[model samples]
Target chain A: MGRFVIRRLLQAIPVLLGTTFLIFAIVYALPGDPIQALAGERRVDPILAATLREQFHLNDPLIVRYGYYLRDIVSGNFGTTFRGLPVSTIFEGKFAVTLKLATTALLFEAVIGIGLGLWAALRRGRWEDKAILAFTLLLVSIPTLVSGFVLQLVLGVQLKTSLGIAFFPVAGVQDGIRSYLLPGFVLATVSIAYLTRLTRTSLMETLRADYVRTAVAKGMPRSRVLGRHALRNSLIPLVTYLGADLGALMGGAVITETIFNLPGIGQQLFTSVYLRENPVVVGIVTVLVLIYIVANLVVDLLYAVLDPRIRYE
Target chain B: MKNPSIDTHPPADEVAQEPLLVVDNLHVEFATRQGVVRAVNGVSYTVNAGESLAVLGESGSGKSVTAQAIMGILDMPPARIPKGEVRFRGTDVLQLSEQARGQIRGQRIAMIFQDALSALNPVFTVGWQIGEMFRVHRGMSRRDANNKAVELMDRVRIPAARQRVNDYPHQFSGGMRQRIMIAMAIALDPEVLIADEPTTALDVTVQAQIMDLLAELQRESNMGLILITHDLGVVADVADKIAVMYAGRIVEHALVHDIYKNPAHPYSKGLLDSIPRVDMKGQELYAIKGLPPNLLNMPPGCAFHPRCPYGRPNCVTDVPPLYEISGTRGSACHYYREVLDGTVQ
Candidate 1:
């Protein structure tokens, strides 16, 4: 198992390099000059622009610039923006905020999704099942952009002012962990819907399996039959989805972060892309790619744990 | 060969005692979108302690469904008992509360299925699954249960029982897996063991081995055994009596030897003739004509009339009741005399 993990880690190096290079090339190819944009509608002195370009290797070919970026990356240097702020420095606390938000979203997705799914599966063809199916459909239909703003208005703004409940802050991370609740739910909304449906289908299928019938014949109570015999098999697919979705929640937080005004890496990523900060953009993407690879590896390892038929070797 | 030692019945006084299990006038139905499927209609049979009764039928004959109904494991939303009693030692288990029925299920009346691969939980070790019978029913410690599991595995003749006990169901061969299933079913020393097509999924050689193992185990424990199968060949040596089912009802009931030598029902004769024989090498094997009737839309009258060679006009309009051929035999056919006397024409 250890060898399998090590081999997987070794295989990830090429993936990391390929993805980072693609992002680097794409950002370099975007129309518009970052140096020219830096002057912002005013005419920049040609000599000063030339000196800045030379320092930042703006005249170098894409391959040479990428080589320099790789070298610096290897040496623990993520490079600097036009404002002379290091990319790593910009990422320092913001990554933690994004992590917190992603974790919160994941927790919400798991608890509510699996709970609703089990309920729906067990009560299949009943009113409760129909109600849960309808609710998940509604969640899936609404996009995060709409859900984030709408929830903010009702729960954060309206309730705080009219009811004087002060239930949640309208914006920003001033209230620490409490501030992430609204945005986290908004980020998790669609995922929660998909997961609930998957859970329902998986649990329903497992419950019908011949082994489950044997469990029943073994005289196991309904609860033990479901909890022990059915639930373990049902959880395999859900774990795979949740593990991969962790990286997605972290990377896909742009809209939610913007609406809630949380100073997370997602907000930084949006700003950096607009300002054409190639180094910051590429650095953040590299970290995300690494995170994605690690998450997938963990998911693969978890498969061996959940199913005895699957072996890493 | 039928072993005479195991074939011995109890003394005359106990012969009159209540049989171990009785499934009387049992009806099982499924509510489907197409219509209500009457899967089992008034099927009745009795199994005595220290005896084996084989319920013979092809697929969809409600043999397995009858077994599931007895176990109280039928999913009731779609499956409704609606009628009949499953009496174990004179108690109607169908009337008992689910909790009470559950207590009787594994501890008193255990069951094994045909496909051992799907029947055994894949993720758990064989030891854990076998040990579960003890842990859940007897409240044994994990270690004690595991030790008991190993002992049971050995009893079922699983090679290297101690080493193989920790392996998953997928790791075992088909024969070995079935042995594990048998071990698990018999772990609690239940008075009755219901095996549904237990040897159907196994190869011929392995099938013989498994049947032998079951018979040997039955002889040792003297538990009443209900062997449900489609194969007439597998039942000859193991089962003392046979109940052949057609559609959802028992069409024939007799001693195994009587059914083999001369079947009173044409359907039973048809089944016996279908088996290939060296003496009839040049002739094409006889097949019972037509398929079993659809449960949703069964043909009126005798369910087997369409397939019976001697099917007559009344056979089309009148359902045949089980007529007593002798004190210990019955056949659900209007012309049992003609079929038995070879006067069908």
Candidate 2:
């Protein structure tokens, strides 16, 4: 097992390197100079612009700039943003907010989704199963942005007056738990639908397995048959989806955050790109890529733990 | 190969006075997408306490289905017992409510499945799974259950029961897993134990050991043993009576010695002839001509008529009822005498 984990960790190195390098190249290759964007609309002397370019290493060759970036990255420096803020400082504050929101959303999705899935599977061919299936399908098909706007209008605008002052704060993450409730729920609904369907299908398949039948014949109660035997075995496929979904959710939260006006890494990335702040954009992309790699690694390790048959190698 | 000393004890007839389990006119069918497939058609048999009854048939011959029906574990919507009475201690099992049936299932009647590797849950320790029977049914405490589990493991001859009790099913060898299954089945001292092809997945040597274990356990407990398998050789030493099932019907039912020495039904004759005996050298061992009949579209008369070597014109038009040929021995064949006397050959 130790050997297998070591092999997997070794394999992850090249993947992480490739991802980081690709994002670095793409951010640099995009049109519009960071130096020009930083200089802004106000008039500045050409001599001063040249001095600024040299200071920021913008006049250096692409490879030389890349080497300097790599050196700074190795020394735990992500360079300074075009706004002259340290990349780490910008990311630390924004990342904490995004992490809190995303983590809460994911936890909510997993619990509600998996619980709904088990309920649907157990009550198969009944009205409750049909209702859950139809509702989840509806939730899945509706666009996340549209859903967020709709929820914001209903729960934030009209419901506040009609339904005894709406419980959740419509925008931002400042109003404690209530402020996060709307956007978090909106972000989670789509993922919850997807996960619930996946879990339901996987659980249904597991319940029909010969081993489940054997367990039942052993005089195991219906609850134990479903919980201990079927659910544990069914988690293999669900875990796989969870890892990939976590990566996608971190990357995909851009639109939802924009719609709800939540101050998260996704929103910060959007602002950085639009403002042509090269360092912040590049740093956020690199972090997102790193998150993907780490999430996959965690998933691979978890797979080995959940299923005895799986070897990391 | 006569055992005169063993024979001196008593023949099966003398001991057939009290039946431990009696299954009468058992009809089982499955509602599939195509249609209702008659899996078990009017099958009947009896097993006395301390007797091992072997229901012999190839795959899909309704052997396992019969066993499952008897154990009350048949998945209902798909598998329905259209007609039957599985009476244990004069109580019709099928007539009981779901809760009542569950009460009797593991406590009174237990089943050991074919695939031992899959029979046990892969995630849980074998001991925990085994102990669950006691914990769930008997309401034993956790410590008591664990101790009982270790005792069971030791009884099955699993080495180092103390250490291995914590090991999952995947950690054990195939033979050892099968032993664990046997231990679970015998844990509660069930009155009737149904072993459905218990050794089918084991090696030849392991198969012998499992059979020996089953026999030893049965003798000690005096439980009615229902050994379901297609292997005629397996029943040679263990089964007191043998019932040959074909197309879901018991075509031949007799004492094990009688069936082996004087097989009456043409299907039974074919089955006995097919086994490659050490005494019968290179003169081509017989193979039954065709596959067992499809239950969905079974033949109008005897289901085995298409495959029976001694099939007659009447055999194609009429189903033969099980007729008593001698004391406590019966055959569903019109020409039983001819087959037994070698005239059919």
**Cα interface RMSD of each candidate:** 0.6, 1.4
DockQ scores of all models, one per candidate = 0.85, 0.58
Name the 10 consecutive residues with the lowest summed lDDT in model 1 chain B.
B1-10
Model 1 over residues A207-275: C-alpha lDDT tens digits?
999999999998888888999999999999999999999999999998999999999989999998988
- Using lDDT, give the best candidate's number: 1
Best candidate according to TM-score:
1
The global C-alpha lDDT for each of the candidates, from Candidate 1 onward, is 0.91, 0.85
How well does candidate 1 score on lDDT at residue B272? 93
Q: Which predicted model would earn the best DockQ?
A: 1
Model 1: number of backbone collisions: 0
Candidate 1 local lDDT, B1-345, one digit each (tens)? 122222223345544675778899999999999999999999999999999999999899999999999999899979999899887766678877787788788878999999999999998999999999899889999999999999999999998999988899999999999999999999989899999999999999999999999999999999999999999999999999999999999999999999999999998998899998899999988999899999999999999988888889999999999999998899999999998888987
**Model 1, stretches more than 4 Å misplaced?**
A40-65, B1-16
TM-score of chain A, every prediction, order shown: 0.95, 0.91
Runs of candidate 2 with Cα error greater than 4 angstroms are A1-14, A37-67, A297-305, A308-313, B1-18, B278-285
Tens digit of lDDT per residue, candidate 2, span A225-305?
888889999998888888887767777888878877778899998888988888788788888877888888888888888
